[model samples]
Target: MPEKNSSSQLIEPEDALLEAFWTRAKNVAKINPLEVIVGLDSVSALRPSAYSLGDSSEEADRLCKLVMDGTKRATSSWVASYQAEDAPLPEVGELSIICDGSGTPHVLARTRKVTTVAFQEAGPEIAMAEGEGTFAQWKAEHDAFFRRECEELGIAFDPDGQVLTEYFEVLYSH
Candidate 1:
């Protein structure tokens, strides 16, 4: 059976599909460490680095346009142990296919950098990287989002919680 979309669970393509994509990706670059990320879908694909943003199909479509236009270049995530069940921690130069909320792969990108920082340390630079809003806005919005996530996981929200931040360069539109 397919897995549920809980905070602990990361949605991804099936193993067979993932393997097939990997084979194709390898032809484009030697040693491509391919991954799948939840993205927004529309004209192009707006691939967010994390799934906690409550991305809808229409929302994803808008985000997709931003990424394709080279306006949105980065995404972040709060580390989850469950992800290890599917894939390893991201590494620089790894490739990712941005999928919509429905798990349809839409865009391909290459990881450029990954940084770990405390939740409270998400600064203007990070917010700017997301192209979402100001640092204050990012923190306020993310705090609420993470709060609900913590509740679902039966944990406390640490203002100093650590997050995995990733920067990527878009490589393909489809």
Candidate 2:
């Protein structure tokens, strides 16, 4: 007659194998989206630029570093989130860098207005418009810069023809 294997009399070796398997399975389990966002935000805070002095002479460099670090952190978190589930995609956003007339760099959450006189002292005028011509030119340049930065960061923009202007408006309204 074959011997019966009862739970109470389970062998130590078999119990160890079962425990190890469970541990591995739990490690591979998906994390919640909210949890992923929290993780991303935490990671973002740990980045060097995230803590840099905004008024320092190296503000521009720091801003660039912040954007790069933030994007990388967010992307990593996003990938982890995606692996954990098959619904509710993470929202994507743009990073914009604009320079004033004095060549001082300002990081915009998205594309927005900056005065014309801000960039004029930097060099010759590039474009002309009424009311916010200088601001418009600054925006145009910032948009180009933002696109380049996104490319460098390897993050894809929205595919539905959303432009920086719309992005700025959304950001500003909020």
Candidate 3:
């Protein structure tokens, strides 16, 4: 596990690996045309970019593995810093690779839905969706997490601030 300064970091896929994977995918495409999804040849073609999931390496690795295992299906973040980072908001039906905190690609995921709600709105429904724990736990943990994040970024944490939530499905495991 490693520590990171950012929630998500983009990775530039290796061309050699991409070409090899494409060749194999192409062969499979011939057999299961429907199974072969397009725009998978190179990771860059997957979406606006491939990214990691958490601010710290250890947490990112844990979360990424959880997502790959289908144990976690949703995640949320403060919209302000996300906007400040200029990262693209997840959109429904977009495919992107998930990398570890160390910036190594680990799995691919397709966004199923996107939601925006205030911090105060983080409740049982979203907590259940996150699969992290109970709503109370989610709220307390998220409040602390966001506060630390705000302190680091020199920003204020507003309980009413919008939080971006994304629900996704694992597309490929590696």
Candidate 4:
């Protein structure tokens, strides 16, 4: 099957594969366009991006579990890294298919709000939504994460770098 390029990975729609998934997701979500929704689109334009987080399979599993439990609602990334990688940044009203460790789509997420702030500006609100403990811990962990990533990529890590944050809501799960 042919593959389509995405942010930092590949998603092979393979004609009906993604279409079928969208149909199933909509059904599981119980979205009745004629009743509960007014501008619901058809499956003709299935544009959800799929992704799996964490470095290890176990880590991915843990993060997915957090997402399923609604403990994780937001995500953060470095704007410079995204730009360098040519990854698509999260946008409002965009749908994302959150895959498990094995890359199987499980939960569907819809972007609600997006904010960009200096690294030092990510506060308690962001920390709580990330489900990664207190603000101080989140900050320290994030700083270390960005610095490590930058070092690995041979790029400079700016302490006041811009952080692109996405706050999403889970729409469906299967």
Candidate 5:
């Protein structure tokens, strides 16, 4: 039921299991983000962030499938949420472990691009990149989602608000 491959969704990463997963990815992919990205060798104190996609199990399942199948490589997040939680935006070259709803690691990915755009400016380009439906459908869904999230956080949802869009490439999958 877990979903997501973005560093911004980072929950608390479980170190022991994550280290094992990282080992497997390094062996198979023949690349280590720790070294390639942070200039640190393997087995350092640093570890990739871990997180799930949606708020529910079903959403996680659907989104995870999209990511694994390569149909979805981009994701958008509400900047207000990050501000409320005092979390930084996702950055290029960042690595993350995407987990299923059961909290088991499933994929290793690295961010390739990060852009901040106005909600109203996100159109067909963003929608198509997201591999969702048509631009209209994507807009409607995202608008509703933002509204719901804003309500929960006691923040105003603005179509003109900024959104953090992250484009990532999967490095390995289990």
Candidate 6:
């Protein structure tokens, strides 16, 4: 006779509906930071800079156009919110983009407590710190909560996991 395994639990129908709703909402609100960088670079370069001259001028223009086009593509492909209110909520940390000498972008999420004095000196700093912290925590909590909810709903939680470990390692190494 074959040995029987007895640790499986059945999912409930009501839990399934809630999990589906949460997944959809979470999926709809994700932002691609690469698109933001592209957009900013594209928009910023069109304005003449003090260093624009000779051969460098042509290169600058080319870079600007490339960035703009790339950003446009990224923006269109990913759901991005430009609105201030729609931006990630405020918390206590930030996600920074780390670029190599070649200008390749990588995300580095970090947490730090801010002093009230620093906030007073720079109004925008406070908002930035909050947004970064909130976004990081939200992503973590959402993943755990969603996974548990899915399990309750009898749904497998594997959704093409993108490995953020490599990026974090690169960030910490620096």
Q: Please tell me which predicted candidate would have the highest TM-score against the true structure.
A: 5
lDDT of 2 by residue, 13-70 (tens): 2334333433333233321235546675331222111111122234434333434333
Q: Write candidate 3's Cα lDDT for 1-174 as tens digits.
A: 234345553334454554454444434323233333563434333232456675566777888888877778988888887776676777887666676666666665667999998898766888887777799988998888888777777888888998888888765666
User: Which candidate, 1 or 2, would have the higher TM-score against the true structure?
Assistant: 1
TM-score of each: 0.65, 0.21, 0.72, 0.77, 0.81, 0.18
Residue-wise C-alpha lDDT for candidate 5, range 1-174, written one tens digit per residue: 123465334333466777899889866866755574565654333567777676655565567778888988988889998897678889888888887554667788889999888998876878887887788988898888788888878888877899888999998987
lDDT of every predicted structure (CA atoms): 0.61, 0.29, 0.68, 0.74, 0.76, 0.27
Q: What is the C-alpha RMSD of each candidate to the true structure, in Å?
A: 8.7, 21.5, 5.4, 5.2, 5.2, 23.0
lDDT rank, highest first?
5, 4, 3, 1, 2, 6
If the candidates were sorted by their TM-score against the true structure, best first, what order would they fall in?
5, 4, 3, 1, 2, 6
* Candidate 6 worst ten-residue window by lDDT: 72-81
Provide the global lDDT of candidate 5 against the true structure.
0.76
* Candidate 2 accuracy as lDDT: 0.29
Q: How close is candidate 5 to the true structure, as a TM-score?
A: 0.81
lDDT of 6: 0.27
Q: List the residue pairs that clash in candidate 1.
A: 40-60, 41-60, 41-61, 42-61, 45-64, 46-63, 46-64
For model 2, the stretches where C-alpha displacement exceeds 4 angstroms are: 1-133, 157-174
Candidate 6, superposed: residue stretches over 4 Å from native? 1-85, 93-96, 100-103, 114-174
The stretch of ten residues in a row with the least summed lDDT in candidate 3 is 39-48
List, residue by residue over 107-167, the lDDT tens digit for candidate 4.
Answer: 8888899999999877799989989789998898789878877776678999989998899
Off by over 4 Å in 4: 1-20, 30-44
TM-score of 1: 0.65
Q: Candidate 4, residue 135: CA error in Å? A: 1.2
